[model samples]
Target chain A: MSLKNILSEKKDELLASWFDRILDTYPVETAKFLKNQKDRFANPVGQAIHKGIGDIFQELLQNGDIEKVSGFLDSIIRVRAVQEFSASQAVAFIFFLKSVIRDGLADISLTPELYDELATLESQIDSLALIAFDIFMQCREKLYDIKANEMKNMTYRLLQRANMVTEIKDAEKETNFIAIHKKEVNS
Target chain B: MAKLPKPEELLQINYNPPPTEDWMDRPVELKQGNFCWGAKGKNLAAVEFPNARDWTPVEADWKLPKDWEGTVLEAMADRLSKYRSFKVFMDICVRCGACADKCHFFIGGGDPKNMPVLRAELMRSVYRKYFTTAGKYLGKLAGARELDLNVLKEWWYYFYQCTECRRCSVFCPYGIDTAEITLMAREFTNLLGLNTDWISGPVANCYMKGNHLGLEPHAIMNSIEGMIDDIETITGIRINPSFNRKGAEILFVTPSGDLFADPGTFTAMGYMMLFHELGIDYTWSTYASEGGNFGFFTSNEMAKRLNAKIYAEAKRLGVKYIIGGECGHMWRVLNQYMDTWNGPADFMEVPKSPITGTVFDNAASTKMIHVTEFTADLIKNNKIKLDPSRNDDLVITYHDSCNTARGMGLLEEPRYIINSVCNKFHEMPDNTIRERTFCCGSGTGLNASENMEIRMRGGYPRANAVKFVRDKHGVNMLANICAIDRATLSASMDYWVPGVRVTGVHELVANALIMTGEKERETNLRGEPLPGKGGNE
Candidate 1:
């Protein structure tokens, strides 16, 4: 049987392990809310992350389509990049899949051909981490954007009060300069 | 108490050590920046609030007048005598921890003082020290301490930390309303001219000019004209809205934040479109432009004094009734405090929706109705035409503004309006919404950026709930009635639940509204394209 078939068959067990691992990263108190909440409206982010994991596994096993793999990775990474994790910690979950599969399949002896297929599966995840790094960077960039926007709004309002940014074009200039300076500041 | 820290050390974060000493033990040291800049003596004196002066909160000494402690104690005693509610709240806590976990601050930051029980204890400890016989004589054992600088600093930090959303009251078995306690604490702080620039600046501006932004008459017109131009761009209709027009049937008063900001301005646009469609005889008042009273955050007398202008403006405009725009605390002041403070309102008739003729008997005493209540009635009567499909791009959830939901029991009206106008609607976790709704965390004038860290921690519970819905339902829009919510939740949503758009309920209404004799549209009100018609698909 193909290695894809072997992994696809045990997808449920692998996913449960991955989900449990991710939940363990949060503080115990926060984990309770994220775990027990079943209603989508009540725990949307938790539920989204939970559902995205299974979709991610199926897409990887069923087909290694770059678009499909990136789509699933985007859903998971966008949230983690935003959460309290550092950059390395946020991307750590992506690599966990390799261990889950390796640990789950240990009993079966792999011939050279199957071992080669498993190597292919490992490389797929390696490719996924690069996409995830880009997505994570994008998320952090958006966060800095929000902080920048807040500072600009505060300054703009103050400048309005001071009669410095009163002219229409200058108001536009202040907004533009702040936006450009924000990118420079972030970079 | 520890020695005062330098000003630069103020931002260094530390959670106070767990309570090692008895409940009566003196509180921990306070860092600077927890308290706001003192109310400008000039601004306080202008508004006639006692002891208003220019003193920084960071300074070691306040330069209090002789007998200042006596003045504070006497003021508390006097307030206790007058308000049975105040006295009862001060006297009756069994130290049940029911309200501790309920505070957003406690949950987010893990600070014990942020717990509502502990936050309220700052006052209760002082009350025991001065008022009770046991506390007066056997102070420390009686869980009391003399009012000292440390206790005062603690009060300023925790009281301002509270958004006064009254979520704690919902959980308390004694029905101890923490908002009352928070307001009272701030009222006492006013005795020393202690206030923040974010607050006193607005109070001074509102006292002289009719709005908090210190907006002048021409400036108000200029801002509204800009809205009119946007309305013209979207609908090809340049309908002129009137200001200060005497004999207009209703006087419309909304928070000036709506005139100045993005999401609030969008909601203001919603009001204009709806009112213009009905041809309602309403006049906007630059003189009474503000609806949210910051003075309510200060003291009862100041709240009353600021609120007095709403009725005064209604009388001046010769309007039969008032129609308030989408605002949060404005209605709290209107429903609970306004009638008591400035009414017979005898000159103005009870408000009845002109379009649907639904006499709002609930507001007969106050003579003003919330805009959501007004809009809900119109939707129920089919007086307004709606195209819910225009909101197809949005999978929306309604955030119950704490004052509107708990203070006024205005839960159903906003939800009913949202349901009628939007095809996609979702409720957040039951515990996190409606009467149990969490605060936007920046209410009561703590919305400044310098305080963003505390604001985010305080906002976590609300954002956590939003993330739940955003993930589960692909929810993008969070609609609320409060102007402060519109501004502050924008920050909160961006921080914790990015990609979720915060909007006013009226903005959703305007987006779904299909006007008579209007051209076919490719976009909703913010000029975002109609779903499936343009880019969103």
Candidate 2:
């Protein structure tokens, strides 16, 4: 039987195993909130991840479409980006799927022919991890951009009160703020 | 392999920050980008706050006048006597730590000082030092400290960080409101001209121009005209809304932010449409254009000074009652503080909805009703028809603005209005909403972008909850009543949940209202497509 057939039939077991591994990464008390709760409203991040990972597994085993894979991956990764997860911890779940699949397929021995097919699948999982790194970088960049925007506004308002910003209503408000500071120094 | 962390490590949240020594031992250091510039002397002088001169929060000496401590203590004693709630709150607080985790700042930033108990203790410590028997003798053991400049700076930093959302009071067994303590602390600070530009600037503008943004009569007209153009685009209805018209039965007041900005402006359009459709005899007041009282953040006196205009203008215009627009602390001041300070508004009668003839007995004392209550009354009586499908593009969730939910118990009215207009509505987690709601983190005039760090950190818990709904139900729009929420939650939502957009409850109302002789709509108020007409939510 093909790998897709095995994954499709034992979908329930794989989902259950994958869910537990993700829960194990969180604090014991917090994990319960992320695990035991079923309502999406009560445990939204947990629920999205529980269903999201399952969707990722099915796409990988069935079609292996990069566009569809990124969609599921992006949904789950976005939550982790804002959470307290370190870079390694955030994307480690993607790598954990390989073990979940292996443990589920433990009963069947991989002969030479089967070994080649499974090894190729393992390589694809590594590529998915690299794609996750890109998403993580993008999220962190957005976070810093927001922080920078806030910092800019805080000082800009202060400068406005100080009469340091020389921009007229229709003119550019900030000529790199540095130029205004220099003008203040010269004056 | 678990070596010592770098110096910067302490700045980061410690997942489980250890609770070892007394919390008093850990001093609060004011971080840059987490504080507001001191109130301008001219701004403070405009309203006669004592010693309204130039000062800097970051400076060590703070340029206090002689006998500054005496002034603060006397003000505190005066306030304590005048408002028993402040006195009782100062004396009580057994430090049960029930309110520790309840604070959004503590949960988000992991600062022990951000704990509502500690934030209050900053003031309570001074109370113990001067006002109590044990603290006078026991000192550090009793959590008492000298009311020095460091203590003053700590109060300024952390108290401003507090949005005055009052989330902590819900968890306190004694219902010792931290907001009561914050108001008193802020009042004492005003004696020294120790206030933020973010707050004092608006207070000055509102005091002089009759609006917070200093919008004159012509400017207010230009803004309303802009909204009318947008309404014409979407609904094809040209409606005339009068300003400061005498003999109008009701005077309408709203936060001026609604006229100049979006989400809020759309909600403003909803009010104009709803009123024009009913053809009520209500006129907008350019003179009392501001519903939000920023002076409420500084002191009770300044707040009263700003709030007097609303009733003053109402009385002058001979309006029977008042309808206030969507605002958070505006309601808190109106519901709890206004009548006590500025009333016996005996000239005005208890507000009765002209459309439904429903007597707003709840507001009988104040004669001012929230716009949500007004709209909900109209909808309940079938006075207006709403097409919920027009809002099909929105997968909406209601954020309970901290003051509206807790201060006035206006929990159901906004939701009732939202449900009547929008097809889909999801709620945030139980703990994050209703009276237990987290703050938008920028209330009490902390919405200035300068203090975004603490705002983001304080906003984290609320944004985390929003992120939950956005992920689960594909909630794209967060609806709230307060103008501060509409302005500040947009930033928090962008940072934490990038896709989720912030909007006002009435914006959805305007979108769903099918006006008489209005054309079929293909776009929303933002000029975005309507759901079936190929909108990309």
Candidate 3:
């Protein structure tokens, strides 16, 4: 059988195993709470991971739109980016799926064509992990940008008070200095 | 050489925490992104706080007082004797774990110490060792420990981590106020000159300059003048607001944050427009310019001292009654502690709406009414006209500021005004709002940049609820009454749910209010185009 067929047949089992491995990153007590509290709104971090990985798995099996895959990856990685995880640790869950898929299909016999298909599937996961790394960096950049923006915002009125910030009127923008200089030169 | 393990065996990951019989055995690490910088000596000296010296929390030596232990214990004894409620909260917890998961910090950040019961136990264990009879003999068996430097560091770390939102108290069967314990712990820390610069700087500023932002009288006018200019641009009407004027009939007080910052600046513009439309007799006070008392985050005496200015300014201005602007902890202090702290405002009469003639008997004792309470009365009495279509672009949701919802029970008034002003309003899941509402995670002077990680962690649950509505209901605007909510929720929403923006309820009100002789409006308060007036259109 092909690797896609094998993955499709054992989809539910692989997804559960992958999710448990992803959750194992959090503290044990927190993992228990995240697992037991089933409400999506009440347990958002858990819900995001649970739903995110499933959507990603479906996309992988179908070789579907990369944008859809990135979107799902963004939702999960964004949570971990702001969390206590390093860059590699945040993207480590994608690698967990390889072990899950291999273990789920270990009992079956393999042909050369099936082995080649498995290599391709593993490469796709690696590609997904690369995309996850990009998303993690974007989230981190956004966080630092937010912190810098907040510092500026906190002192915004003080900046105004010290005559440091000026509000440029829209009418003044129409008469650009460069345009005026060009007109003067022509004259 | 050892034989190589199988791939599955190599892949196995352990999730369990290291085995420790007691949490007390885990030493505090004072991790980065978790704690704020220590209070500056200049700031403490400005307010004349005790043991005013330069210190760093990361340093091994805190430069504490020689008799710091005696200072803390003596202060504790004094507070225990002075306030029966403090003593009751100290001895009353049953350790039932009811409030363990209720704390936003605990729910969002997985550290077990973030749990409300364990956070309180940090203080309770020390109390048991000193005050309880069983602790002296049993020691570790009695769940008590010595209050050494390590314990003090733990107290500082955990107490400041709490935002004093009081979400845990709602779930506690005994109604144990965990926020109060944090407050007491902070008070002790202050005795050793241990205060976060975020809180102490503002406390000093409020004491000297009459606001946390330290705006001089002229600076306050300059900021308001800027808001007035924006109002003119949006509505083609010039609003003249007076500062520290006497006999104005009403005195307005609001958090200084509204006067500055995006989103918050828009909220300030909304307030001025609403007031100018009503043609009510009101004046802003540069003396009591800040409605939020940051000193409330420090010590009780400092809180009272800072809070005294409101009533003092009201009496001096000779206003009939006071109208307070949107703020979180300000209302907590105003509703629960103001009357007890600096009250008997017998000089000021009960707040009666000038336009609607509605008497605010709820604020009979305080003589100060929340602006929403005032505006809701106006809307109910049909005192002002509103075009809800002006806000057609926004799918709005109200986040109940923790202080206003739990401390004052002023729930329906903001909702009433929102319904009258906006076309779309959606309530987040019931468990995440009202008295059980999660904190902004950055309230009570913890809204500093250095601790953004923990702030985002604490804000995760609230952001999660907002994200739910943003996905399901297309909610793009978060409306709140608190100025800090306007400032901090903007950051949190941007981080967690990018499409959602934050606003004050009155910003929506001003957007919808149709003023007399006003030119056709194309933009809302922030100068953004109204629903159908976009550049594309």
Candidate 4:
């Protein structure tokens, strides 16, 4: 069986499984949104499915013609940055996706021979995604550490400057107070 | 100033009795010729790279006697283990080299090796060879070298050369601080009783006595009395800086050396003047006479013992607040280590400067403060009189000492004081300034005559920045808040930028102080009045 035919047969199972995994950790609103979107594309679902599946391949792998999917992935990563999710958290989120894919594969019915082939393909995909996730996390952590340390040092310098100004004021006051008192005593 | 004896002469002084058995088994090499010098002519500058060759190997029989072995050996073993333990941390680094350009020392000195990652690589390479399983098995394939006696000696020499300034951490992607490694190495070396007399003698003195300078109780009192008399002469303030006065509202703890030394003594006078102006109930503690922790140069135990006096004295005085004086590592040790290591004092209240009503929020987890912060707040609240004209001729530039600026994030307070008091103030280049500050080249007690080359090399980046300002803005005076910075930069200024002087930020403040009876404050050491008309000369 060709890869295209195989993916077509398991398309619904894949989508349903991914939706469930994402829904498990995410809020009900996000779950509902995905479900509603799925329902709207069910009529022309095969082509839509092909496109969505193609997108994931394009986004995850470097060479697939899945521009839309890659764009979506980029948006998600960028949004995660806005949320201030650390590189560690992002890597964990990717792992969550892999588990979802595994659970979805479990629900699909197929011949034993075909099922074995599919499982192998799934594992290969999982390995690729994990490697990519790890690399991204490492880079992110490095950048964040530098930024944080710089901020810390800058804050320290500011505090020291503030402390110096305080000392100057106190010194001036003492010098003036004594001078005034001395004058009054002399007069 | 007369030059001190050569390294050879100084080493033979029998300053402290040598340890009986020396664990060091490495050969000593002294290189002739000007190797690390930076400047030319009278300003002949170079950094002495203490390599494996400078250290002399000691016979096992010559090691500290068995009775002395417990403390010395255990301390050495502990430090060595720490050096070994940090191998995992050192090896785990992916060598992204993100920290390369981030170091002010690297940027200022233009020395690639000063880059934090590169500096760590020197130690990491040694660690990989000895400690890691991959290195043990694969050898050259795993990029590990053999850790020989020479390697150990090299580690002791080169590691001490680092100031333990955390400037490189600012650019490190993993927040890997070479400062921590430097401290660990120093601890290990000191345990073997292989310390330069300059730092070790002070550490031992601060440990056994109350102060690093070996100032007796009377000497400390007399110094304060002298400051009081100077205050009376300048401003007619007969304020007594009471020592060991129980139940004062504040226990003003300063680096004891400051009570005896120049510039620092002037800063001490500034503290007295401030305390008098605010009319606060504060006393100097004879017990905790020193805020400067030389233990920071060697072991944590020594650091803890030196730091213990402050709280103990604070408790004795029953003061609400303990204010620290101008010192670099003193603040770093206090802000970063003292609170957790020495624990808290329930007897003392959380510090609130009475003059400013500024309540410290335990931000750094310590109830103490840098004196500049206390006084800056008073000025902000309009509690003091300052004449900007007094500092008219001092085209001042501020040097952010690594400890105050990097360790504690205290950049603003000192600058605020400088801007308020000095009529003309210029800033050094932004990259080498503030949080990214370069060391004064002699931090971490590497200020000995032997280490002069390293100090000058480290100070090159800072000196260049000062030079840039002097060339462009005509900045002739460098104002800093750290005592070590004052000493280091004063030496650098003398050599690199002739006629440019260094003063504490407080000294500048004292100069601009507005005494009511006087027509104008004497802002400059030259006795020049504030520039322009109506300025009393």
TM-scores, chain A, per candidate: 0.80, 0.84, 0.87, 0.44
TM-score of chain B of each: 0.95, 0.95, 0.97, 0.82
> Which pairs clash in model 2?
A154-B450
Cα error, residue B39 of model 1, in Å, equals 3.8
Residue B359 in model 4: lDDT: 85
DockQ of predicted model 3: 0.38
- lDDT tens digits, residues A10-40, model 4? 6666556653543333223223333344321
Query: Which DockQ value does candidate 1 get?
Result: 0.10
For model 4, fnat equals 0.00
> Which residue pairs overlap in candidate 1's backbone?
A43-B468, A44-B468, A44-B471, A44-B472, B41-B52, B41-B53
For candidate 2, the lDDT comes to: 0.83
Q: What DockQ, between 0 and 1, does each candidate earn?
A: 0.10, 0.11, 0.38, 0.01
Error of 3 at B481 (Å): 0.5
Clashing pairs in 3: none
Off by over 4 Å in 2: A1-187, B1-21, B534-537
Which portions of model 4 show Cα errors greater than 4 Å?
A: A1-187, B1-88, B100-115, B363-365, B516-537
Question: TM-scores across all candidates?
Answer: 0.78, 0.78, 0.93, 0.63
For model 2, the chain A TM-score is: 0.84
Please name the candidate that would achieve the greatest lDDT relative to the true structure.
Answer: 3
lDDT of 4 by residue, B214-247 (tens): 6667667766776676667666557776889998
Poorest 10 consecutive residues by lDDT, candidate 3 chain B = B12-21
Order candidates by TM-score, high to low. 3, 1, 2, 4
